[model samples]
Target chain A: MANQDFVGIPSQVDTRALNRGASDFQRLRRGLLFNYLILGAGAILMIVPFIWMISTSFKPQAETVSFPPRLFPINPTISNYIDVFDRANMGRLYWNTTFISVIKTVFNIYTSALLGYIFGKFVFRGRDVIFYILLSTWIIPFEVYLIPLYLMTVQVGLANTYTALIVPEIFTIYAMFMFRQFMYTIPTELIDAARIDGAGEWYIFHRIIIPLSKAALFTLIAFYFMWNWNDFLWPLVVIADQDKYVITVGLATFVGEYWSQYGVIMAGASLAIIPILALFIAVQRFIIEGVVLTGLKG
Target chain B: MIQTIAQKFTGRRSTLRAAEHRFIVIALVPTIIFYAIVKFYPIFFSFFISMHEWSLFGNVSPYVGFDNYALLAKDSLFYKVMWNTMYRTFAGTFLGAFCSLIVALILNPIKRGSILLRLIYFLPVMTSVIASATIWKWMLQTRFGLLNQLLSYVGIQPVAWLQSTTWAMPSIIVMGIWGGIGFTVIIYLAGLKGIPKDYYEAAEIDGASSIQLALKITLPLLKPVVSFVLITGVIGGFSGGFQAIYMMTGGGPLDSTRVLALHIYDYAFQRMFMGQASSMSFVLFAIVLILTLVQFKLQRVDWEL
Candidate 1:
């Protein structure tokens, strides 16, 4: 960092610039070091729960309640995981959840795109009214919908069925709203251009609009997938059969039943968490950027 | 930007041809019907259910107009639950906002491995609340919890975090912050991204310190996003915490951790007091609706002050 080896007489301005450059360099380094220490500590705090959960999952039952806790197991084992599968029907939970989440997400995204396209692109009577009505429903909390929706499910003979799980949530508003906003970015001229080419409406949607909407599409897909995967409340209220349980409900019940069995329960938690986390981490770049993108538009 | 485009759509409605009109009708008609049945009708039916003595098994459900709401007004436990809900909502939202702002401020400056840092922070946000609460419950465990073990290094004794009435709500609130901070941080970061770097460079040329730069340059500009996070966070907080509380404490330790969501679920499902639960949900609905209106009004006010 030394600049004392200058061959000729340095101009006053050059010395000031050099001094400022060195100070700026030091300041930048200081800022980076501060960031590392503070953010590093914060990041560790954030993941400690996950690390502990994973660590506990590998521990023996006896070690779980031991006086002095160990971050890593002295004798790591997979017994807790086996116990989760054996006792909690973790595989069935995974299958049921996957089936439900996939269907629900598909329905949610597709319907929202269609409706959003209609509202955002089309010029029709009462479009704004209809769109705003649907948008307004976004404010109503799911808690308000829980009881009556459950009762309605039973009344319609859809109770305890996968239909109950997916039907009530088929037309989600938030994603639809997002799609509608995203639709604005698609020029009206494109639709008009397609129309002039004698392209069918659905053709334009499938070939053009859908393809053009990859940005919002991927982001909303990632988010809704995660939300559907982690959804606990509605599923918990509607599905009562033990075999029909989703992962969140299964985990809740598992934790309740195995309240004191820290190791196996943590294993169950791990099983419930890992697939979604893995999926998220894989597509995380899209998600993080998508959040920033939608955060503004939303 | 959104306003202008939306206004353009209003002022200049495209002349619809038969096929385009059909497409619009076909897509929207069923969706409107779906919304009416699934979303709108439920509110009315829930109101209807609220005015009666309803249950899962009983057949002789008698109508009792306004009684459920009246009952809630008088019930001490309902009051406690309201207090708990407000306590959790305000504490969780505000604290989470503050922490996220700080994290985002510190985080926005770093160029290297920022994504990794964000990913680590967002770990819990991706994890199911039930799973997060399970891990939190174990960590807050009195005998073998990680928290107590860590606290012991400073000569602090083991505290029954979920068992003590005093500590239980705070514990849940802290957990709420943990589950939520990453999300709000992303919002703040996005807002931070909107700010042009020229303001900072100009201010720095005038010898503004980092703290002053943050206060004078960053915060004032970031007000809209800050309030957005706080408003949305508070709104969500009212109806949230069910999965977490259900897993962690089950509204126990003297119902200290009980919020409106948990209480509503408990009454309807466990106790079969569907009428009362519906009424409580109405209360929640009103609170959320009011907050939303307030949000709208706040947004309308130019964020100058």
Candidate 2:
């Protein structure tokens, strides 16, 4: 009966099934090719504006306002770049941004990791409660804190100073949470072994924990550097001195002052992007990991 | 003798526990204190000042309970800005997430040059808001703009993009999508990567069509990721929409692009209405809190998986 039942499934059925499968495979392959074509076109759309910016930056002022805009400059010139550097004080903006970003990144990584280690490893009274309270602070937007924070900074006489620019940003709640999540994956045995060897808590943290979590540290560095480098609002609010202004605020002010100077503005914008773009391209993986890790966990 | 020994052992353990507690406190106090000073104190202070009549550079302001709140209630621009904010949040989040999902789906099957495409898409995100918005603003110029020029090639008349109030918000929304889609793509890509391949293979063997496979298998499986992207997109749109608007529109062509954050900023800094701005800030905070709670409820479902 089993043999008869098997035979009842016709050879024609097998052949038809095979043909359908073959056609389905062909359709899928065709669909994938079509998708690639669409995605290729989308990629061009994504990249053209940047190309346009660079092109405009290189164009002569006359050509920037020409009737039929050119994708590439008709008469490319370095005058815009020269003017931005010489007149707009690009060098000062670069220095201020780099200095503040570096200082903020370093402190952010250290404090975030230290607090993360404590939260992940320690058992103390009110640990969960304190951590939850800190986490809830993430919901409060910077606008909510803008008034009092500004007032506090002003009262302390740190307004318009690099100290104001770099201090408040260093202690971020998100980075602390990220580092804590990263630290949770680290085994307790490693710390225990260090402690057994007479290592103090600070020694174990500085040596074993920090070294083991280099990936997370690097991730936070890239994240923090980009954030601080691109921060506009806080710096705009606090820093009144043009010499102290970060690249973002300086560029914004440049835009306002030179609204019609398209070529110079584009040039300034291009230069401002180069440092962070280089950083991003170099550490793209870490940035992606940091973002993904936070997305999944948060 | 036994009692003495037990006492000594217990005493030593208690001291060790005390030392551990000390270490914990020492390691954690600075961060907790800093956070309290920077974050918590300002939040409370903001609330306190919201109830007062304050001004920029003023040391003391008379307390007027609910007066600022009352002024906000009567301010018609406040309602308009709220509407603008909600519109941008909903429209931008939807368009951004949808476009990113499509891109992710397309790029998922392409083994070649996927990373390169991702890099290209993510470039705008890496660029500063000022730079990107500068380029966008120039492109959205009514005449001789790149966008208009491109439209002309299709035999379409040039439309005033940022200059017209009707088109201004949409223009910002479009740029918002462009700059934001990369983040959504990357997140969705990560989500796509998490979907197991064997399921697809099994479905193929069963003669499940590609669209069916996507609808039945992929969509259902990616629900958690979709929710994450949507919720975060909305949250980000509410809080951070100010930068782009500030750069591109400066809250007009008629305040069409004025969002809550920009409104608060204008009240506090530009207009020097600190008390009114603080009240508005609390309202924004309340909205964010409600949204965040909703996200938590949704995320709990994701966590169960």
Candidate with top TM-score is: 1
Q: For residues A1-298, could you state the per-residue lDDT of candidate 2 as single tens digits?
A: 0000000000111112223444555656657788779899999989888888888899988988886888778778999999999877999999888988899988888888988888888877798888888877777778888999998998899998998888887777777776787776688977765554456667888899998776677766776787778888888899998888889888888888888778898898899887898888888655455444534443
The weakest ten consecutive residues by lDDT in model 2 chain A span A1-10
Report backbone clashes per prediction.
0, 0
Please give, for residues B192-280, the per-residue lDDT of candidate 1 as tens digits: 87788789889988999899999999999999988888887788888878888888899989999999999999999999999989999
Interface root-mean-square deviation of model 1 in angstroms is 12.8
lDDT for residue A59 in candidate 2, whole number 0-100: 91
Q: DockQ for model 1?
A: 0.38
Q: What is the TM-score of chain B alone in each candidate?
A: 0.92, 0.91
Model 1 chain A worst lDDT window (10 residues): A1-10
lDDT of 2 by residue, B126-206 (tens): 787888898898888777678888888888899998878899999999998898777678677667767877898899999
- Candidate 1's C-alpha runs over 4 A off are A1-27, A286-298, B1-16, B301-305
lDDT of 1 by residue, A1-298 (tens): 0000011100101112223344555557656688789999999899889999999999998888876778889989999999999999988999999998999899888988888788888877887777777778878888899999999999989888889988887878877777877787788998876766557889999899998777678767777788888888888888889999999989998888888889999999999999999998898665455445544443
Model 2 spans > 4 angstroms off: A1-30, A285-298, B1-20, B57-60, B301-305
